[model samples]
Target: MEGKESKTACSEGFSSIRLCVFLLALLALIVLAQLAQAGISRIWAVDDGEKVKRIDNNHPLATSSDNPVRDGSEVSLFGAKNEVSANEDGRFVVLPVENPRYRGNELFRAFENYYSPRVRELRNRYGLDAVVAGETDEWKRILLLRHWIKSSIAIDNENPTKTRGDTFAILDAALREGKFHCTHFSIVQHAVLNSFGYVTRRLGCGPGLKEDGGHHGVNEVWVNKFRKWVLIDAKYDVHFEKNQMPLSALDIRDEIWRDGAQSVVCVVGPDRHPMKPDSETGKSETRPDTYRWCSWETSTNRFTTFPATSTSTLIMLQDEIFKKNTWYRDGKPHWAYGTPYMILTTRRDWIEWTPNVITSKVTIEDTKARVFLSSCTPNFRSFQTKAGDDTWRDCSEEVELPLAKKGRNCFTFRTINLFGVAGPEHRVEIVYSLDKSEPTTPGTLFSESFDDGKLLNRGWYDGDVFNISADEAYLGVGCIEYPWEKGHTKPSGCSGVRHLFEPTEEVYLRCYIKLSPGWGWTNRTYHPHLMHFLTTENGKYHGPAASHLTLYVEPVNGKLRLAATDIQNKNAPHGLTQGPLRGGYNGKLYDSKEVLFDDSKWYCVEAMFKLNSLDVKNKRPNADGQLRGWFDGKLVIERTDIIFRSADFPGMKINQFLLTPYFGSGLLPHSQTLWIDELAVGTKRVGSVSPPDSSAASATSWGLMLERINQHFPFTFNGAADSAIVYANLKELTSP
Candidate 1:
């Protein structure tokens, strides 16, 4: 009876075990199915066009759009209701319209600091490209760079050099002390990767347990091969990998949690050899415990000026199962752990964002679609676009594509780096309709010819010292004049005119001016402030010399200049980036390469000033503002990237115009008379005055001006390397 019962019990146990195994297999399938669906969704969200959906919720992704959809979200495309979707190939996708409720809140700017001129100079000066030139594999190149830095600088934690994140200074110190800390290693590594066109961020790691004390600084670089961020510990010349795939900080932590560090492989040196146990410690170089917690610096470019700690930091923690409040002592946050000012996010996507990605916006009007592309690509070269079956064509960031058909219009965009590497393609589709209104033109805000010989009647103020003379005029018989006595700086008592209008984001001023024969230049860097614009943030009668925001359009040392002085903003939080606080003046100067002004000849001068966009939600300023100058219908000075104001003045506008020409106190060279005629201001270009008679003297004057320009500044004209080409073009345009 006992044998029979035992056999029966054994059989029942086997049956139960089989059932459990079956259930486990079924659960695994379900999980795999869900993961597959998620993967498909991610691809659709970024790559494919068919599954693209409007982000209606207040998710972080919504911040990428200027207009985010909210409650009762509905998007209209080509007079149709929200019925946009991509075709089967996913080659084209429809983008949502602008969301009015969405404020300008962006995780990253259109231009990242990795591509700044400073970084480019650093790369060239250090020959960073040649460091990895021989390496064919991208991963090998990264490893090679790590090894190079480690071999060059020795580790010295006890007395690390205090170079404060300056790569150049750190390298210079490396030659003397020959040692530094992990922070220095990571700083140099981060900058080197950026110089090579790889986006990177400094990572700070610490132990999770309170009893465990110590910290380590490393770097996480974006590797296009794996399409993910990989951890590179330059201090120890090591990296973590699993199944031949490089691992990130979070990856290492998760691997330790799953089983042990047995599966995690430690890769060391450019040769990609397995790391050996430390001679003294008898432990692996990569301590998994050290990566229990991780944080990244917010700005990658701030390392040159100061340590990453000076800028905002972002703490990234795992999911709830691993997260612990005990990480903060007494449940009180710490800067090293986490603080109120520091952003703490459980989402890994926020920390491991894709680099060198193209962001696009599409606007459809009439039979045309305007696609505006912006990117944070390092070493960005140009944007390439393809329409329908057309081959890819290199185009500007903003392009207008024609919609030949009424149905599906597909467009694909990608950004190319300086190294010829192309970013992931962003495909978009739009449905077009021929029924649309024509684009409207901007209207004139204010115009003055002085031909009326009156000021008060034409919306002019502060013109007490103004005199309308007929001595010389570009078009009309009357012109405004200001006379100076010999050795007298302001004998006319600051003679000028002011015009006030409704607040405007942009304004264009056009006028014809002629200086007295043998007119003299200030010869100093600054002075002879000619035309100026004051923002609405300041009083209408505010002096342009020192005000909240004063944009100066004048001649400095005979060169056309577009400058800004915001002495009032000297103490603002963002003052440092704008200009320096020298004594009581703070401003930035943008001068033309060629001197566009000459004496005793009427010249057409026009200037356009546009305010930069502000990320109001984040209180950040964009550097897309423009200041353009035209000399006799030819573009002389063009500055598209400028920061005119900070977020503190969100409502600022160019409301007041000043035509005050003054040489700084006692700085006027000599007595000279300046005359202006046919002055006009409007929301659009006011057009230029016709050239004077095409006579031999007129041609000679033009030739002399060109010669003087070349003599004063011989290198290039507005960054163009071929100055001869520029002169040739100018000669063709100005030929009699």
Candidate 2:
């Protein structure tokens, strides 16, 4: 009996061990399932107050790649690899591509007008900034400005000012006559909003085609806070809203059409109280039915070139029935056809477009995600980025964010304007895995150090007035020198060299140079042409001043300057967007604000030139070309919006480089000699050079001398801090 009992105990113990092992395996499976679920790619948009909404993968704003093929070492989130499927996992992702409907459209190019002198004058003349100084919220400022305009100018539709779109003229007439029309109020409000760096458009609204002369004019301002347009009727001191969010004209029209205008609320006055029928007049301040038909100008730059209308008018119809009828007996609606040209379309995007919204393209390489951001923000300041739960940090237009290897990673990007207003947020999320492929580095197209003391040996051509010298070199024992006679003013005294390479859309040039003591500038705007890039559309020996496209990099009056001229394209069908043709030479000049070069010391100067993208299908040229210059490792000048070519030269590229130094006829201030060395060019940025100790005599000697002085006379100085400051200021003034 004892033997039988012991055997039973052993059998029970074995059963209990088996149960423990099964439980451990089940728990492991559950944890693995949870991790796999968390790794699934998901996108979310976090708005103000941390409101998060999950966006579906099939949403118009979301784009994904199920089997992302590698482009070099990086995987693009769009293009041929873009495919969406529920079964496919481990995909690369990016969010909403910039709406192509507004990409390069001219009607959307209103940001440039904010820099107009007229806009600035209007802001200062009326104390517009002071009026909204206490308001931190951008929407509140918009309401405040509207109230100011409504209170300052009374309404009188009978004797409206004849100075239609001019803000100053309208205000002058209102001050004298004490009243103006609704059109004048909208014009004034549009100008004021633009002066404060807000994008606004004037709209003319009526009940429909049947409404004859009872049309009203109002303004629709882009509120970046909500990432939508809000209609404000300054003349009536009212704006439409639904659910606490401001409604655009189209929104109000849609709401009224679908639900009988019961949901739409009309808010009036600066206090934002609900609209009620006047106690004496027995009429509401604003009616929602007025937005049944809307018309607007294509361009918001009416105040930019006052008294000269350059934009077409577009009218939006509610349905096809309205399209067939005419508002006027002559079949030409005066309100819609007021401009030189007009178009009627039922497309809502053409009438109501959103601006100041951030759009991005993303790529994944290993554990890093690169985000390229673009926007139409006015009065642009800087871009801000947030990674996961991290704090928002200011970043450049192009930023690289890190991704977690084991789980989900998210990033958000937005634009901040100069007035401290933040635009809509663009978010991207991805599940990362390691990519073992090696990244490729850009190869050098051409390099020259003059260390071999030979210029004719390389692929250099047209070498003249330049010879290799062994004295005062920046990098090696040899450098190229150019000597100008004391009183010489002829082109023969200039030095030049040309190098041709494979055509490329972008190029960077870096060189170390030193000007002679007391080197003077050609005080006039033109001349002393230094370095130039010529496109393949021009002949190898074509003059840089006139070509299909010629980019100039030079120092003008001690300031680094980057300029472009396309005289060969001046007569193209598109017309010259950069010039007015001055004596067979015309171009736009971008000068650096700081004096970068003033002393006889070796300085490293680098310039980057990138051609703008072209929309061949639409036959339009985008004004997004870039030109940047750096002096001694510090960026001093940058111009992102430049028109380097027209559609006529769609295949243009930088094929030839010229290092010519010449002053225009009788423009050379004095005979000056300069030295050039370590010239390098590449498709990617050929960064600044670091000189050896022996070559960095000026900077090294000054720093050492200051340190010794501080060491000996410690009481006379504030220790290392004061000595460092003096050393830095003196270095900047005496050297590069």
Candidate 3:
């Protein structure tokens, strides 16, 4: 066991003597800078053997071909002659970034691209470019750049602060304000690292194992030394290491969840110990049988990061990465559109080839503009356009499909035309249903066969959505579903599992749900609690619940959505106490803004909740917990900061897995019923057992990282799957 730990956890190269010396030198510089802390805002400079060059307004370096490119004459800091080609300001795009975000090396291209002159100017005044230029080790260069970013961009907590336009404009804002936030800090680091030809990406971080799970911004540099991406949190002036090896955002997420928080520690922070771990269910709770819904949203709640997709997300995206939102898994949606050059659209659910299913004709269509519809997969295969609304001619010659796996198949095609206009690559996900004729194994987590006609009482309990019927079953004689009746208004029933007999850190729940022919027939409205997590006192039923988060099937803004939200704190008064409506913390609405769920289709809905521990620093009410859900293995909604309690409320815990299908105060558009079968709750990944690739969702670079993590990490590795299916380009995570 110790040997295994050495191979995976403890073997990262943080203990190298070279890095040790460099860190010591950097530490001394940090101390000296601290002594001159008063000038931190006014002048952020670095020693270049002879003088410290301040990057304030007094020292100006311009890159405008439209005007003079310099106010002061350039000086040789590193003794290397510097050359920069000037270009128009706003047209500069950083990175020309490749997909599989964390590992891409856009730095060289970005530094040499049109943005080079402006970037070089910024680098010269700051003086770190010379230091970075002198370093041969990518790792050391990253550290040097990290120190400058931390030293230069002071954290701005004041709200009156404002932002300018575009990436260059934001850099101007940062220079002017002198003070910055975590967002600006990463932006500066990204530009500086790229300037020195070190591939860099802005990575988003969520709460620690404790705390309110605030959104934090960190940067990852593709280090040649490690041959992999490593994290740098300039805000803390530290990086994360496990067994002394640097970590990526994914690594941090894995370590925090898989094995608890023991091996995870900060590289250079006052709190270098493990951030904390998933806390147990709080004591002093009530019976969940009496629990009802509570509404909450925090007006003053601010700390953690929000996804770039959300309108409420607060971050300055002046850099190209921000403008493009490439920090998260982003480009998977275009796969359905065939190829950009093809410009195809479809009414059929992406290429289905499963058992007992007919190859019905699926409508395929295309429009001029690639809305780049957000999907678990890509929207188009390949793409390029000469002029808007003119002609989007197909140039992708085409590629042949690969052999299909026994269970599922996937295909992709990419092309770059002679004009250098690249096409959006096509990614295909097709599931060849597992052989039902052969013996089917149970999912990695718990599996239920309703043939016995009752929920196993030991770990599972009966709740609101519990009605056994042999009418239609996935396998056994019985499948659970809402009582089907004419004009059913408030149909609600449920069954739940207490706590896993083994681990409690993270749990993935999977179940087979089939809408009755009545699924959405009422066509009026559908608010079905496909499932809900209830906080229990002792893993058993606790009542008058203080916390609960739920997942329901409802039509939101004309789209059928699988939404997730929990009970909000009533006393927090974040935005709740307006008048008669007394609000507490706000519940995050898990809407991916995509409508993929349809009725009458046998769908597998899976959810994983990594219960976040309560931290002393971020006390009461405010919570940034994680709740992820997938339909047919296609990610539909994700919520990282889901509030379930208030300052006085207890820690957020999901005790009861309630399959509550109900409409609170209104009736269904018409009488309608919902059906369910084969429910499961376990510590392992409980994914789709049939058609639609469970593994298909994970078959990418992100999937590779999750696989490597499961093997490279110790036995404490939390869940087998790194995350529920996410539709974006970069990998999405739910961490401590």
Error of 3 at 734 (Å): 44
lDDT of 3: 0.40
Deviation (Å) of 661 in candidate 1: 66
Question: Among these predicted structures, which one has the highest TM-score?
Answer: 2
Q: How many backbone clashes does candidate 1 have?
A: 2
The residue-by-residue lDDT of candidate 2 on 513-564, one tens digit each, is 8876546677777667788999899888888876878889888888888888
Candidate 2, lDDT over the whole model? 0.66
lDDT of 2 at 505: 92
Model 1, position 415: C-alpha lDDT score: 76
lDDT of 3 by residue, 1-736 (tens): 8787766643665445545444445543443343233111121111222222332334332222222223222211111222211111111000111221111111111112323355456566667656666565546666866776666555664441466422344456656765656666666666666555554556444432122323455566655455355767675567767787876554554454445545665555323444332243310011110001110111111111111221222121121122232222122321112232221111111111011110111111221111121211111233332323544444333322333322223233333322122333333333222122212234334456553334555346544235665434553335665653335444544343333334354567777776543233333434443465555423445431234444344334334454333333334444221122225322334555665545445677777766544554665433565667777787776777654333443544444555445543444443444667667777666666542233444322111111111001111111212112110101111010
TM-score: which is higher, 2 or 3?
2
**How many pairs in model 3 have backbone atoms within 3 A of each other, for residues 3 or more apart or on separate chains, i.e. clashes?**
68
Please identify model 3 stretches exceeding 4 Å from their true place: 1-445, 456-458, 462-467, 487-505, 521-526, 537-568, 572-586, 613-615, 618-624, 641-652, 691-736
Task: Tell me the alpha-carbon RMSD of every candidate.
Answer: 32.0, 26.6, 32.8
Most lDDT-accurate candidate: 2
lDDT of 1: 0.64
lDDT of each: 0.64, 0.66, 0.40
| Clashing residue pairs, backbone N/CA/C < 3 A, model 1 | 67-99, 93-429
Worst 10 residues of 3 by lDDT: 289-298
